[model samples]
Target chain A: MDNPKHGMTLIVKTITRLTVGLILLFGIYIVSHGHVSPGGGFAGGVIIALSFIHILLAFGKEVALKRISYNVASFFESLGAIMFITLALLGIGSGYFLLNFISKGEPFRLFSSGLIPLYNVAISFKVGAGLFIIFVILVTFRLTKKDDRE
Target chain B: MLELQILLVFMIIGAIVAVKTKDLLSAVIAVGTVGLGLSVAFLILKAPDLAIAQLVVEILVVIILIRATIRKDLPFSTSGRWFFNTFVVFVFLIVFLIFGYICMKDLPKFGEPIMKVAQSFLNNGLKDTGATNLVSSIVLDYRAYDTLGEATILFTAVIGVLAVMRKVGRKK
Candidate 1:
């Protein structure tokens, strides 16, 4: 009996394995430099989520799930939401909702923006995890239904 | 203006092809090409943010559409209903064009913005927010509430999708 792999051909898998890391890194860069650049947490996070999805397409569901399990993804999603809210709430400490409480360093520096970069990070995590969860749910439901039928 | 019109034409062609194409994959590609054309238009309009967002979104949409098609056989609409569908489409198109004409008649022409709120942001966004990037200053500082609302909507959507999928899985 052939225990076949779930995803695409060898070349695709190999390319995915090689490029997924690069994609993830690029997403992080975009998220971090969002203030200075065109891309932001939403865009970067989507790219980050897509990177994981690329793996899922190239390798198999099992392999991709192993890298980032459903529970972990769910946890990050919640955590990101909490962090975003917390950032906003913390602004209240400065006498305004979502105020820039921290000292803003020199412009163009990585740490210049007060709470903005942190918000970007939180948003990136939330968006990335949420998107991955949505994709996983969409893909896995049919498989689970099939199992139930069996 | 010519470049912008060229891009719009490409997008118009792409939209027509996307709808008319029988093959699901080709339709998706056509839609993606439309997205690309729209992004290029955005770039020409000097909205880098919109351009980047559009391009990324278009890619994600194509991926999702491809994934969806992988499971089901996606047949184009048969010629039997084509006449009716085409008629509806044309009616909508005319309605849209008329609405667009009405709106555009009063609207500022391309790149000419009569901005009040935007004027404030443009003038003092840096002085107030201490952020060099005005776009970031506006989004993260000047209008954080709107961003919060948007993020919440996204969260709600993700949760809804997850819940719906799980229910379908359990029922089956």
Candidate 2:
């Protein structure tokens, strides 16, 4: 199979291969530890989305799209929003919206916060996929000249 | 305080560079420098969460802006009316200074709670939400409605962008 030249030079590709997984891992860490740490869902999700964008920037659209298609990203984005709303609605069982119903575990622990970690996860998914798809759409879109349109 | 002042100066300088530069790519980088300085200033102000968010968001913005500048055949020109632009800049600066002074007068002293609500949150946020980080507790548990609205807005924005960018919205 003949492979046409795509993406950046060798150095950028090499650096991207090495760093993308680490960036993704760090983003997950931020999201999971949101309750106990500085970074929460929003920041972590942005980082997660950036990782995918980094892949697209370094490896070109085809390879990046192969890994996570536009449809898959859109699905995850909606799924995240639905999961968050459902979590909020579930709080009604406790007599209030978004009320923490589960037992609050020991403070300062990883699994301590009731519903917070879950919220973080949902938000991360929503933001990450939403931003990724936005970047993909904006970058891949081709604008034809007025002459061509005419 | 001195460090923050220095950072603010650097940010101002970067903003000036961003405005003065003719090349779109250089301007983007200069703006990134300002954002980086602001992020560091956020860290100095002890808002680590904002700092992290600012840093990452700055990186992403720079990346996206650089991509946009590089890939397009943008017919950007900086030879516009200089006197009007300078007048506008001066007007903006004066207004900003007035607002800044007013805000500074009204703001509570640093590290002090200005509102009973803030004090209450500080005192009981951990106990109520079981999250050691007060910001997280408040954002997720206390102000979840706001977050829901924010998520909905993001969803709407994505859908709008998809609709506008799609090659075909309806079948012929």
Candidate 3:
């Protein structure tokens, strides 16, 4: 298991390579179309995080971390929260926090919702990165190797 | 309604199996089955958002639970106090029944929509928020402060996880 060059069996690797991209794309579709669809930021973000976890399970930590490291994920998690708060505070000038200030475009269109798409994007970033971070920490943390940590 | 009742029965059976199973992996999968039934029930009830969310969350939870249990030392020691355990269970059942009785007294009739809020939301949600989905608008626009609070709670939870999982908590 400590080969570090590969992970799992060849069959699992082949299947993961074929399906992981599709899962990520589907998550993006869900987030982008949240205002018109069943899924929104939280659900889409969980799907996105699951995609990364799939890679980790099939290809091991080295490859998965090479794709998106812990530091980068943590950075994006904080950045997402800041972005969401900034969007909310932008509404304060109108006597309300998180007030829909943008022009409500023609309904049912892709870009119709005033600030909903942006909020979805922000929340997706937060949830996806946070969940992935939690999974990585929980999976990688070793009780015996405390002193020789990464 | 028939389908829902069947699904509920399946969920109850799964829960029983989960509690009765000795193998940790089997127990986890049984619990996952219960969640899967719940997700299906949500879909049958016309709650696509909740169904989708529940399904995805159930998948993640099962994976995490399996990871937490597999290859770990098993501790199945019993205290040999069945009488006390039964007494506690009886007390819990009494409290649960009382709460259920109170809730049943206030529950509206089946198929009756709570028109107070739903009517207005359905009538004006699209015009007000310019979104095709009323649920999204309600969650992200009308009740955005609620969403913000939820986001904050998630952020705090992540921060706490990071803090507790840190390799070196003190500057040694």
Error of 1 at A144 (Å): 8.3
Give the true-contact fraction for every prediction, in order: 0.52, 0.88, 0.79
lDDT of 2 by residue, A8-85 (tens): 888888898899999999999999999998999999999999998988988889999998998899899988988998
| Angstrom error at residue B32, model 2 | 0.4
Order of candidate numbers by TM-score, starting with the best: 3, 2, 1
- Lowest summed lDDT across 10 adjacent residues in model 3 chain B is found at B70-79
Candidate 1 root-mean-square deviation in Å: 3.3
Cα miss at A52, model 1 (Å)?
A: 1.0
Off by over 4 Å in 1: A1-4, A143-150, B74-92, B167-172
Give candidate 3 regions above 4 Å deviation.
A1-5, A145-150, B170-172
Taken over the whole model, the C-alpha lDDT of each candidate is: 0.83, 0.89, 0.90
Clashing pairs in 3: none
Q: Lowest-lDDT window of 10 residues in candidate 3 chain A?
A: A141-150
Best by DockQ: 2
Q: Score the docking of each candidate (DockQ).
A: 0.61, 0.83, 0.80
How much DockQ does model 2 earn?
A: 0.83
**All candidates: CA RMSD (Å):** 3.3, 3.0, 3.0
